[model samples]
Target chain A: MRIVIAEDAAVIRDGLSLLLTTRGHQVAAAVGDATALCAAVAEYGPDVAVVDVRMPPTHTDEGLRAAIRLRRDHPGLGVLVFSQHIETRYAAQLLAEGSHGVGYLLKDRVSEVGDFLNTLVRIAAGETVLDPEVVTQIMGASRRTEALRTLTARERAVLAMMAEGRSNSAIATALSLSYGSVEKHVTQIFTKLGLPPSQSDHRRVLAVLRYLES
Target chain B: MSFRVLLAAPARKRAWYELGYALVSLPIAAVGLIYLLVMLLTAATAATFVGVPMLAAGVLGARALGAVDRGVARALLGVEVPVPPPFRPRPGLIGWLGSALGDGAGWRAAAYRLGKPPVAVLASGTAASLWGSGLVLLSCPIWWRIPALAHLPVNTWPRALLAGTAGAVLLLLAPWTVRAALLPDRLLVRALLGPTRASARIHELETTRAQAVDDSATALRRIERDLHDGTQARLVALAMSLSMLKDELAETGRDDRLDQARVLVDLAHRNAREALVELRDLVRGIHPAVLDEGLETALATLAATSSLPVDLQVDLPRRPSAAVETIAYFCTAELLANAARHGGARQAGIELRTRNRLLRLRVRDDGAGGAAMGLGTGLRGLADRVRVVDGTLKISSPPGGPTVVTVELPLHP
Candidate 1:
């Protein structure tokens, strides 16, 4: 798949291009500004575009604005915005534009290379993959139910892992818990969160989130 | 003429707005007020020598009226007219009557009162004609799409064109012409209100002194608040947590298993350190230890560590309140830091002196002068610190080399 990257920092851009290229994806274009990124995307016709929320010429929301403009101008284009700060307003706006073809994630998540790439691929494939941190921040900001407050530290940990799209087996390994125990914790989380039983990974996570948020 | 140049004064000098208001408009108004006052006093004497009853009536009328004029002037000019100066004579019918009759300012004030009717009519008429016409004329470009001259015997495109052209001409002349109309009112106001430049300076200094004293009091309160809120509050929470650990230990009767007690002890020690550190910070906020040793001692420590070589001089024997000393120390330290880090100044120098009842601290760096703190809060915060202490801090770091910062605090008793 072809990808265009717009990031002001030369080192970070080089690293990202190197990382993506090594992952069997083509870096169609790489640039340091929103305007150039938009032009490059139009020229290269990339399948997915990864943009830093802060790019040059007013190192503020220029890149996010370019993202929104791209989405408006080219509705078919897939976009994933990475921000140093958890500024969810842009993320919410992009998601609200269309649930598909868009994803917003913290810059740190990219360090978890394989998982981050999976998110990019999901978004490019027109699947919704909201950053769990962003979702939690938004839910907290909006002052939803006391589900977060009532959650045991361990349960919250388990939920965070699930939100990261970790498999139950992966979560068991990470948490140093038996697979049986992880399964039980997942069941308790769903029941405590008031989510109806579901086997589909995406639906189960969404249901648990909807319960916690509401 | 591009008005954009007038607008784009660079980001740093956006403070030109504040400077224009303070240095230009205020002093001009103050001088004008003094002028009117002198004229009124002269007019009062001429009235008094003419008739005794007339003198009493004129005095009574002037006192009541000068006050009214100040309010009117304050509203129109957007200058804070101070509360009217106190009426003379003590609280008694006889004294009040005599002071009311004898007050020369009242008589002069009355003359201005007398002049008000004609002045108001002129002011109202001119303001309306100028502003209304200016707005209408300046708006021509927006409405010129329906192009025509309207003030013709018949409405037509040619007439609309003529009208629009006239409007453009009128709008072009509006600024100078309006300034002219306002010039008299501005002049009249300046003559009646405030005081002489020297007296105004004295008054400004006096007010600054009052602010300094208030700042000193506020500093004390803030220290007290910090101690109570930060260090004290943390200790309170720690005490409660320690008691909880004690309760848990008592219930368990297992000293060996009391890791929580160890944690609480660690927390208590941590809290103590935190309190001590915060107290030191509070003291630093009051006066840095380097500065506490004295100004020269303080600057020496700063110079020793800074990238640039600093030449320090302290000629003042007595300190100007802890607040003033603190501000001077921090400001000089910051200036030195800035010089070293950003200015690439190889050398920086500071001079401190207390003379003519003012404490002056000047720091200069021989480096790139374009160390624009700009709207950066650190420098502005330093500036505000000076303001709070009833002192003035001037920074002149124009591009090229040699940046200078001067902070002057009054030594008013």
Candidate 2:
């Protein structure tokens, strides 16, 4: 697999390059900030681009903005965002674009090893992998809205993972149900929550998720 | 015939009008001061001996001299003295004394007291010669009747001159002398018991602002520290892993070794991503972007997962200072966390209002009912924050479930 890394910190960039190189996946470019990241992604044309949420000048949401723009500019380009905080705003935006290959999680997930690489693999395979903590904050926000409260506890849980912009398989695995069962639960949740009567899919869930987030 | 008739008229009617002014003003002023001192003592719990009697005196004397003071004020200063509120005691003796202490009748009474001595001495000494001459001049009309006494006293012109001199001296000195007489008494009353109300509202703002500054600084530092130590570390690890993966790939082409290297590379990627999340958390801690949308939107962001229901009552028409709003937001977040973490409360309430040109922000909870402030460092920091704005944070957690923390900040732009 070919990957392009976008992180301002040198240690992380170098370490990620070394790790990828050893894995036989070429890290064609390890760029310093998100601007450099986008340029690198454009030039190298990697299979997946991992960008940090905060980068160089005015270390605010520069990285998040860059990730959003990169995905917007180059459609179908797999992009994963790394954030130190519980920020689902940019992640939701990314998922809203169509939840393919979007990863949002805490940095601590890296030390967990299995979860971190699993999320990475999932992202590479074009699946949305969201951090549990990030999902918790999202669920916390959605639960407060009138639109979300109408769902029962069980249905609400299903909606929460869906709002994470998860795939049907991911939702099933998360809720410990079959893929078909998860799909059924999601439909019931959408109906109960009074979301759009039609257009129930990953994008719709992401749309509703983003709506409840703000 | 007319002159002789006027001279013969009854003296009683003339006498009543002559001394009317003098009898009124001085007496009333004296009574007011005495009443004021007594009331002060009573409020301090010393009025048992002083206040009761003064109240009695003020009631009787103030009424008696009321008309007189009016006549004097009108005659001397041309200022009318309406019949003031009657010397009514509070519903009870204690309340009455408190009211007296609170009102400003003390200095007026004292002025009438101390202001008389020097005034009398000067006026009397200066007018003694004039009065003596007055006796001589007044005798002129009777001089011829007295025969020897009238004829020997002086010529008509001299008598006329003497009368003029006497009256002139009295008239010139009277105005100044009377005004001087009340100076000491007025000063005494003003300083002793004049209204001494200090504004509680102003004092409260000062205390609250001071606390607010402290809390903002502490919060900012905590966030910076969290970022410096937390996410910075992960990014560094990511860099190191990238370095290792590059070197391992160059040395070995085996599938298993490459797979192990792949794992490390993935770890670095995840580490870097997590670092970004930490950085975002730090950003939110500093200023939640939702605040830019508005305070309501920001609050919506906060309610994501509060343990108990947060009843909000914020009805502000205008926005407060950025510092104040930020402090308020953090204060709410901290309080909710506190309630959830410590307060076994079932519900909480938040209210916003303005009073005395202050932004009033309050948060309360219905928990174990015994919520005291010493419970957490978070509140201490909050207290410090409100202080920074020269505002105040009062925590009422009396070992029960319902604990309330109220903050007040200056609303001035």
Candidate 3:
């Protein structure tokens, strides 16, 4: 996959590009600030653009706004918003356009190279990928806490992963469970929450996220 | 041209006020003069035991009348003279009399009372004569028909017209003459009734103190941004490098040395990330980066992260100066912390709004109260901080329950 990186910090920008290049992905363009990020994405048409939430010229959500604009202009492009802090409002806004081909993750995730790369690849494949932290915040602030309490601890964990846009097999691997067991938990969660059964992974994520966010 | 000038003189409200001031001050000065002269004569009779005390009482009386004089000037002449500091007498009868006699402000007021009568006499005399004669002459065409003026030379039509023309010029000159004649009296009132030298110095110091407070806020913001952009970024990058290095070592081999190298690399990565977290917190403590968005958003973030539930309401239709915003943010942060840590507050509410060019931030908590500025440095320091910008902090916390803190700040430094 080809990637464009936009980060004001030079060292982080170089480190990210090097990490991606070493992993056999193409580093198409890397620049600083929201404007340059837009230009690089336009010029290179990369599969995924890793954007820092804060950028120069008023380092306050410039990159998040730029990502929103890019999502509108180029619907097919994948955008992964990376930041040091997790702001639930920004996550809600980013997903408001549609969770397809979108991702929000903490910058610390970059230290876990395998997981970070997997997230980027998943986004490039037009899958919704939210940081676990974002999912936790949404769950904590969700209005249906009373209903959410009905699920068992393991079922809750599986539900959280599902809200993060994970496939059944991915959830099974991460939770050290068989594929059949993960599917069973998913079914139970749907029954307990009275959610309409979603057949596809993307639809399942949207349904679960909407339930929690609402 | 003369007719226009004549109409313009009475048309100006300021001219009318000044003319009134000139007329009114003469009677006030005459009374002050008579009283002063009696006091001086009584003070001159040192053969009696009442000489010195009588003079002290007279000076004190002048000071009292000076206050009334200032009010009169402000009302009519539009002169705003600051009231001088009140007299602080020493203990005992003798000491009080001695201090009153030596009081500089009182002596100056007495001198003004004596000197003002002469200046007032001249100014009022000039204003009254010019205005009175001008009005009489300008209406000569009508008044000249009276039988009492039939024998006068200027009672004829041609002479009356000439006199009326002269009257128009004098009417124009009246305002100017009154203003000029009153200049010395205005100076006398200002120099005597305004604040004394010590209070003036205090005022100067307060201005510089406010400037210093603003300068420090700007400097702290700069330092925090620099740390955020430079040191914190570099630390995160270093952590990333260490993380990558650990991965490289893990792939290299199953050798003991390689495993040890990987462990060291992991430790370094963890430590670097920890350092980054610490630096981020320190930078925020200096100046929250979220504040760059605005105080509303920044306070929202603060409320969301607080240990106790915080109901934050900010209605600032217009933003305040950056320095004032910074001060207000810190004040809110400290107050909330106090509510939780000291007051054992279950919940807190922050209300920020602007009214009458003032930024008012009120924080209330439903907790064990008894919060006092004397009890801790937090509230006192906040008071000092707000005072620098001519702001005020008020705390109303009873012993039983809810604690309310209100901070009022100017929109600008």
TM-scores for all predictions: 0.38, 0.48, 0.66
Best candidate, DockQ-wise?
3
Error of 1 at A84 (Å): 1.8
Question: Can you tell me which runs of candidate 1 are displaced by over 4 Å?
Answer: A56-58, A69-77, A111-122, A125-132, A142-145, A164-170, A178-183, A196-214, B1-413
Worst 10 residues of 2 chain A by lDDT: A107-116
Q: What tens-digit string does per-residue lDDT give for candidate 2 at A171-210?
A: 6887788988877877787676666644434455566655
- Residues A52-143 of candidate 1 have per-residue lDDT tens digits of 88666755568888998888887778898976445445555665565557778765455445567778887787655667766565444333
* Better candidate by TM-score, 1 or 3: 3
* Candidate 2 ranges beyond 4 A from true positions: A93-100, A112-114, A124-126, A144-214, B1-226, B229-232, B235-300, B304-326, B336-359, B362-389, B394-406, B410-413
Task: Please write out the lDDT profile of model 2 over residues B1-413, one tens digit for every residue.
Answer: 46544433323342223223333434444555565455455546544686465655553443343345444545544443333333434445676656654433433434444454443344344334433454555555545345565555454766656655665555434434444444443343334322223423444554575556656645665666466445665554754455444544656766986878777776666666555566656666676655644565566556545646677777788877667777788888888778777877667787888754578878888876555556553777888877766678987777655788888777642
DockQ for candidate 3, C-alpha atoms? 0.24
lDDT string for model 1 (B1-413, tens) is: 57654334222232222223223333334443555565456556755654444445556665555666566556545546444445535344556556767765565564454444444445455545654665665555556455364443424546546666666555445444444545565565556544436555666786787777767756764665455334433443343344334434555655654766766665664565455445545644554434434666666666544545567888977766556666677888777767766776767898998866678888898887865556452677778777865678888888887889888876543
Deviating ranges (above 4 Å) for candidate 3: A139-160, A175-213, B1-115, B118-195, B302-313, B330-350, B363-405
Which has the higher lDDT value, candidate number 2 or candidate number 3? Answer: 3
RMSD per model, one decimal: 27.6, 14.2, 12.3
Of the candidates shown, which would achieve the greatest TM-score relative to the real structure? Answer: 3
Model 2 DockQ reads 0.16
Q: Evaluate all candidate structures by whole-model CA lDDT and list the values in order.
A: 0.63, 0.61, 0.86
